[model samples]
Target: MSSGFDPLHPRELDLPMAVPLRADGALVDVTSGEAALTMDDGKIFAAPSDPAQLDDWRAQLVSWREGARARHGVPRRYDDPASAWAARCFTVAQVWLWDELFFDFDAQRFTPERFLADARERFGGLDGIVLWHAYPVIGIDDRNQWDFYDVPGLKQAAAALREMGVAVFVDYNPWDTGTRRAGDDATELAATVRRLGADGIFLDTLKKADPEMVAALDAARPGIGLEGESKLATERIADHTLSWAQWFADSEVPGVLRAHWFERRHMQHHIRRWHRDHSEELRSAWLNGVGMMVWEVVFGVWVGWNDRDSATLRRMLPVQRGLHAWLVEGEWTPLAVHEASVFGSTFTHDGSTLLLLANTSDADVTYRPEGVGWQPLHAGDTADLITVPARGIAAAMQVTGTEPAELDAVRTALAAETPARDASFPHRRTRRLAPQIPSRAQLAPADIRAGATVRTVIVPSGEHVLTVRHRARETGMYDGAPYVDEWKPLPPRLHDQRTLERVVRLANPVRVGVAEVSAAEYALFLDAIGEQAASRDPERPASGVTLARAREYAAWVGGRLPSEDEWQLAAVQPGFRRRVPEVWNWTESEHSDGRTRFVMLKGGSAHESTGSDWYVDGGVRGPEFALKFLLPGLGQDASPSIGFRVCWEETT
Candidate 1:
């Protein structure tokens, strides 16, 4: 029904027809390589020598007009194919034909029938079949590349495909050492395609000279196909030249088709390099006029030789499916571009919008969709912040008027539909962090060191309480030397050798309100802490304690740390941000040097004169006295400013 025409018939008897009108009300044959209609009634028409194509132009116009009228609910305008056939034909807008034809010039061996048979058998079921010409003559000189033209077998293949109810398209390139010269006359090349009974030509490596060449080619054969190579932009073709070539070819000739405008490259690299910058422009070309074709799902020369494995295939499926739905099935509309710190692409369709977030980083990225409710199609969970793995992609479809309840339902549906993938790290233990306190047995020994700030370690087996400790150095008057200064002596020397008793205890339990907090609240909490610290009196050891007390505070806070799962949950809090400082927390961890002991600092240090504040500001300070703890279940890395917050649970 969408195409408004059947394709099974060898030729149409009652072809729907229309007389295209210019803004000035003059009749224009759209199929002819001639007139173009401008918005302001201005007409730019090219006069071609062969005007006989005018009839074909008129017939196509009538068909388009009837199709449009039917779409608008008009009835009985003309006899049309049944709805089923029309819909089937339209659904298959394009097809790809494998180049299996063999040409032997020495023996003059040519078989059109065999080629036709193979075309129908291989690609007959598709809507339209695109035939790739002879094998790429890799080492052949440009002058002799077109020598295939003189070969009898090549011509037979083209004719056979056309006769077998298949449209034939040939590949032409501007590369050097090929059939055509780099600066060959465009008009002459156009004549060859027109005379060869070819339906269209796929332009390869079209440069700045290509548009004019295509225009000249159109003049020779009004409806001859005029496609461009993907590298035209690389060669610095003017924007106007590229757009004008497409516009002229599309408006003037019915057979003008553009294929492979977006070159095929690795899906991963493509997203990393070009998707953000070029997706919009490529999308515009598809909507503008010319039919767009994506070349390959995966990159490899031979069929099935370098086929994508299931893993890569699965990753790319959402993108390919999403794009197809937007460009072909769904109503076409304009979409604004969104730039994410991670990976994502967005487009609108039929009043609903689609946001695709792909995690290409080594660590997982927490995504929160803005201005809309989103449900993860892959996770089957509903939440404001969803974690996507590195190199993983998630698609979220948001429709207008979707209420919160409806959104939740959609999320549930998608989750149920998606099959979970197996993700295992052989080197480390992993656990999903949630609201409940994780059992001590689930915590793992993670190495913590300078520069190795964040890590995801597997929880080791067995019940164990982790004690973290920070390595301290003598400073100020002590100057890292043993007891020399009378003003400020080192803790070990200041106290009577045998009289001092060292004691440690957990601080008050922190109130847990929610699993995740908002960014604003997180920032505000940090700001509040800073203000409180600013108001503290620095004159007298600040109310709380002595040198021995300060050491105990640092030691107790610095000894134990939260697991990776715990850190993840805290980082993703819905609306609370807290500056983790005060007690230096220690993780059951190690240093990069393979040492068993390491420390993580939180809040600013008590020794201001020792340059602890300077070190923290300069990012040289480790989790010392003041630190915030994050949930490891959320995924850990060194990208964010992370310290630690300690917790003590009674051991049975």
Candidate 2:
């Protein structure tokens, strides 16, 4: 359509949208590994390999970061400088207990002592605890109601924990779900902090909580710390907030690390050490230099933490404590670990540098730190290598005030006693490659008449190379494409990375359902298969169905589960675009790790950004807001919200 369009180019794309182009006319394929910028003339621009080249690239990134900060009006310094420094010095964990566990109907069984004791044993030591929803009745004026700490000996127990150097923080839900007003909440916050001797308050779901409220509380308490629930709080209001590795399921190494690179340095960020593998949690913390909130179980959301999980914490606590000054308020720099699937970062405080490494692979990885001549760290426990076992950690302090040999000895003994484990896999899921699409031979578009409930659309296929525009990063480009010269044993799993434009070749033209499969249709399939359910409402999108059942329903309708690529092609291929429901649609794709099969769920319509085809897995019930969820099983696992639609492959 433009003068740059070369129809005869080898990788020419004839899709509808404009492909993102580099300054030199190269196309940007953010998801490709070899080269993000591919010229129409066949040249490739990859990452710089040499030191001089690398430095030039990093310089460019610094300039870009500074420009962004200026454009966004992000202040160079925190308003409360003392509080900001304090946030870096300490880490935080959370404890959520409902009436069942915290109190129960019977007051006699309230054992605050046992709860605190178990927390100490599991967590080893805690700098702060975010006691969520531990209030009386989720509001302020109802302080007369049986509060979480209202039981007999609870006040003394809280005092005992505070004495052990564990700063206690209580929840202050500003919205209070319409239970209390802002003025009332402010009064209760100050009163609770004094009554419980709390060091601060965790403002949960803090959209409505005005920054003035925080300032007021701080003025009243003089030195109270406040934590917001979201990472967005870093933009303005909160002193601290939880910032997890917000990755799509099936993310690769260094997953979501780049997103927080600059922001983590300026804010008191922390992540809940839940769902993801223990080693990953530690690595994420190390790379981003954020605090970890040790939350193993809250309500029925179990992270399946064990003794090894506890050991993992014990191994890092002292090292983190020893290097608190540097690890918290230091400049965080990422390092490339050679010869292993390793993710690590260096924290420079004063003159000392602490290099923290998390080996995510199965075997032992030998890390030779670049620039410095420190002895190579072995895969296991050793004098130089503070081995963290497999899928564990190893920290080496260089030129620090602390003795390296003593620190290594203590870490080695801990690693030796700790049980070795393979890296734990998260239940979340997504796609790596853009789904394969229809070939040019399959290009056939026609207006088709359909029944009332079964609307359909036809797509014409042609040559398309999936492309996405990406932002520049210190590592070159923050694109979904893997690193230059990166190889993988298995194909990638997710592709919902941010994009300016993405183009994929589509060759197989198929007819897809105008909408997601409906409850009426699912009911018919169930009845046809002699299966019965409790309720069957025909108009609503079918939900609470399994992959196998979805497949059966598709088959009944003379279609099949659409491949990941086909689903996308059908959804956005020009004239084929049709409105779909705000639900997660199950694709035919299945993910396996040699032992378990995880079904793929795509397109988070309600919770995620609209029009983006984000992916979440069907196993382990997704977050509370997830309307579609799956469990760990071989397609038999069924839950509410997860459903599927039908698509038929046609040879025209």
Which candidate ranks first by lDDT, i.e. highest?
A: 2
TM-score of 1: 0.30
**lDDT tens digits by residue: candidate 1, 61-93:** 344334433333332211222111111121011
Quote each prediction's TM-score. 0.30, 0.49
Instruction: Show the lowest summed lDDT stretch of 10 residues, model 1.
Output: 265-274
In candidate 1, stretches whose alpha carbon ends up further than 4 angstroms from where it belongs are: 1-143, 149-169, 173-188, 195-202, 219-341, 362-392, 401-652
Tens digits of per-residue lDDT for model 2 on 608-642?
Answer: 21121221221222211112121232222443445
Q: What's the residue-level lDDT of 632 in candidate 2?
A: 30
Model-by-model lDDT, in order?
0.31, 0.47
Off by over 4 Å in 2: 1-61, 64-91, 97-117, 134-154, 177-183, 237-251, 255-276, 336-340, 370-388, 400-419, 422-652
